[model samples]
Target: MRHSDVLVVGAGMAGLMAAVTAAKSGASVSVLSEGAGVISIGSGAVDFLGYVNGKKITDNPFNHLSELGEMHPYNIIGAENIKNAFASLVEISNANGYEIKMNEEGLNHTAISIAGTTKPTYICSESNNASRILKAKKILFAGVEYLKDSQPALAVKQAKQYKIFADAEINSALLKSPFGKTHRVLNCLDLARYVDKEEGFNWLKSELSKAAAGYDAVIIPPICGTINYTKHFKELQNLGFILVEAVSIPPGVGGYRLRHALINEAKKLNVKFIENCNVQRAVIENGKCKSVIALHNNIAGALETEYTADNFIIATGGIIGNGIASTPDKVYETIFNITIDSPVSVEERSDKNVFGSHLFARFGVKVNSKLQALDSKGSPLYDNVFFAGNTIAGYDFPTEKSGYGVACSTGYTAALSALASK
Candidate 1:
């Protein structure tokens, strides 16, 4: 029933940035996302590497793009455009009051500096916003018992080391294995009782009822249902607590909140959203996409929705996020059915330092200079369908903590070009 100039899917960093830029350019845009994991338990910072141009560790955006091609030959082909993407991202962030600073010593993809292992430069957005909202107040870091016991306590201790003032509280909810022994853990948010079950919800209400009035916010560990943050916020709001926001992923609360925020923002801009609207196939006429047929819900309850667009930008995330698929044996884009050119080799799967302490640290989707989705034969799939972010192939951001950085750059640049094409 609705039509837009661009139909962008997924609400991760790339999706959000793409939608925002496209909408601002006066193009009607809509975003659909099944779910996203980037923000929840993700590094809440934009990452970019630095190079030593002279005595200074010059953070040249061009050099960063070039290095990506050298390391992951299939990773980046639009090397010049990639640099422009980063430049656009820097411009946007600087204008938004978030100043991204560069590291001095030829920035490594990943590094362990005094500051909880500093990797590439982190462009902080909500830097002042997060602190401003929590000014001089204490936060209750509600701990999921099993999770704390399972993973290294380094992140928690490191948060304290960074002087992020917060206190930890353990939830009594326990997760056990078949033998009735504790296997993993769940926080108040994760426990079935507190989330979907009525009894647990009541218990959470009664227990947190008092503390809700005292603290600034209740910080929860990334739980299974954390991605539906709007729903979570409603529950918290009903109990008289202001749901500030969550941190970035492994702990998924932040990504959920970030997705919710983007959707809400889009709605405010009069952008239409059709969730569960799965694009089944694209109709191309004369090498340009004419329309896209989508399935809403399922066959019995499904309604076929057709959207005709002048252009399209694919923000679907990479393999790990379901935008693209790559196992030990194969790699391909899921929606458009495009194959990647020279996907990451199995040998480079895990570098000797499994932790990934180098640049282009994570595996990324490979793309040409125009960011077109490429096939296994190294041919461009479609001229109209451009891509951004993790789906591009070759480079890895998780290891580099440059996931957000690359995603933003690629997303911004893609939207700009799509608009120009129009």
Candidate 2:
């Protein structure tokens, strides 16, 4: 049996943030995860809220929180807590050698994607700062030959369509394949590993200097080193070129770098991380969660391990992350088997339009302002148990573009609430 003051389930941004926050406040924290969360698949930039009332773009996302319904996670987290959460995340990133920069006015900035689509994000990697990219009069879209995901020519054509960059000259350039002919299809992971080495950096510098000549800023694939992205950014800056990293595709190396930094910071705070443990059930006693039973894999066979904690936080993520499971007529919280508040019938969940609202995306465990999990009747399930991240659903992530921000804010708030519990 393992015991801790705080036990957090999941290793995604929310779970990691909760563990780090609790541990820093002098609570003994243990984190268990089935696998790495959605970070690797997400764009590295932190999106607060990009759209409101459907596809309407708002300059200041924070200003429109009041417009959201009562069930929205941002409203439940409150504005002050959201600010504090971002501050804590920035501090953690800086301490771990990965600096994140946000606008001074707390407004969202436009981040250019590899496909040249502009996305509204609150905080972005210093290397991908939009302000620097916007200042350039001439921009060079650079790609590696044989790169599977990034297309320089296509990006240049798409970027030219946007009126925001009309004044800047958009050009395309292709450098030699960073990985040579070893692999037929070069992925972002390969590029990231290549850039981490000194020889690879030198090769890239030489190639970029030639391809990016006469251009004020060079937008390139996010090949920044996974562990030392900031270091690579500085080294590239020393080559006398203004560099901007494009928002990545799935298996995002930049996101992986951010995740690695968070995990390293958590370790510094003495947070115990237990990977490959799938929590199966929670033991409730006297209206409180006493412990959880997890399935652990070993050479012999699967083993059941009991972990007892004074308090527990569920950051297990949403349907996409498999924190909540759904069927034709039912939605369920996996660990506690709590009934999710969703449509009663399958017909109510189905939408005829392909890009229409998905009821399942909004199905998750409900939590109150204190971050405590609530039953269908709005009652706390366990006094010592709380929920954070995608588990506490109220908003659609794709439409709102508030998923990462909500995760960070709710995770931070959940930690504070858990630490104050009796």
Candidate 3:
């Protein structure tokens, strides 16, 4: 029987920003998530698209929405609001001790020239943010096995040119066996077992202990333990170290880092968090929601927990993260069970084309100007339930560098709207 002024579901960028905004505005916020927030698999830059009328080559958030609408018209609407969303994002980033930048060249959308492939690699120059951390003597890279393998070594080498000590190490303690012996299991996350094994964990400890000798901080992917991201950071800090988490690409499992960062920061803010608490369903009476039924788990296993709130932000994320629903047959929403405005013609292409060599993968939920989840009719699902980040739909941010920018923007906007309503 717990209650708060606002209840944020999901810990992704949108959800995190929403909760932070509400909490900062003097609202008691409770964030419920099944796992860590997404974004840990990224370059950690606030990506805004296009230029802002300067030689600096900045991006205009509004233009991003237009570009996205053009690319995936069926899924998203209200292109301009997306831009405004980012305007608010600037405030949040500054408050959080991170600098936000806009690229004028829009080079982030173009193919970066990689050695072997004629196609340029997809990269957002979060150089400014990355540069700040370069001051650190060392950076630790930890995550799922295949995740680290995705990038070409040259990419890491280039980052090193910028003066970053990138050390890639596997945490055997986090490795886990894919349920039942199946070949497909290899494709999934097996690193859980690696981290769990005594020998494996010991090996990592010995290696980190040795590296800890002189390094200033360790940059790790999301290696969340026991569902508490803040706890993991606390333990790491207790060991006397600073942890910088990068973004996680989808299906690749880099999202763990994104989730962990939110968890870590949320704790510092003293925000309340509840995990494994599924929203059985929401009771939206009238235009506002009154309460939600959440399923909780403990040593005794799953139990139903009802939570009441005055405001809410649903940032479950889009298709990639399971916030928006899709399958081999159809696509739709999972939480509110609303009909999604899917594309008229589905792109039935090979897996090779679908995933793409670039990070700007266009797949997931769609949103309108207000950052509200939309139905097949292209209307808002619930005014109170503001959407954010990858789930907002439209734009392929990885390539556009709009992901972080749009996310930060939409997150800020949603919070602003929520606060305004309050």
lDDT of each: 0.53, 0.84, 0.50
**Model 2 spans with C-alpha error above 4 angstroms:** 344-354
Instruction: Find the candidate with the highest lDDT and give its number.
Output: 2
Model 2, span 158-196: residue lDDT tens: 988987798999888888975667646778778878888
TM-scores vs. true structure, each candidate? 0.61, 0.96, 0.58
Tell me how candidate 3 scores on lDDT. 0.50
Model 3 C-alpha lDDT per residue in residues 19-63, reported as the tens digit of each score: 876777787889987766556444344445533222223233443
Candidate 3 segments whose C-alpha is farther than 4 A from its true place: 50-265, 297-299, 343-352, 355-366, 375-379
For model 1, the stretches where C-alpha displacement exceeds 4 angstroms are: 50-65, 70-121, 125-184, 188-249, 298-300, 327-329, 342-365, 374-380
lDDT per residue for candidate 1 within 1-422, as digits (tens), equals 55678877767788777777788778898776666546534534455544322121335444445444453422343555545655555554444323333333333322222122223344432321233233435444443445442222343355454333444231222223112225545432344224445554454455556545565554433331333333444565565443333233344333333445555555656666666556666788887777777786635777777787777777778766777766667655777666554336666544576554432234345566667766657687677777877776656555434577668777777787678778
Least well predicted 10-residue stretch by lDDT in candidate 1: 170-179
TM-score of 1: 0.61
Ranking by TM-score: 2, 1, 3
Clashes of each: 23, 0, 47
TM-score of 2: 0.96
Sort order, lDDT high to low: 2, 1, 3
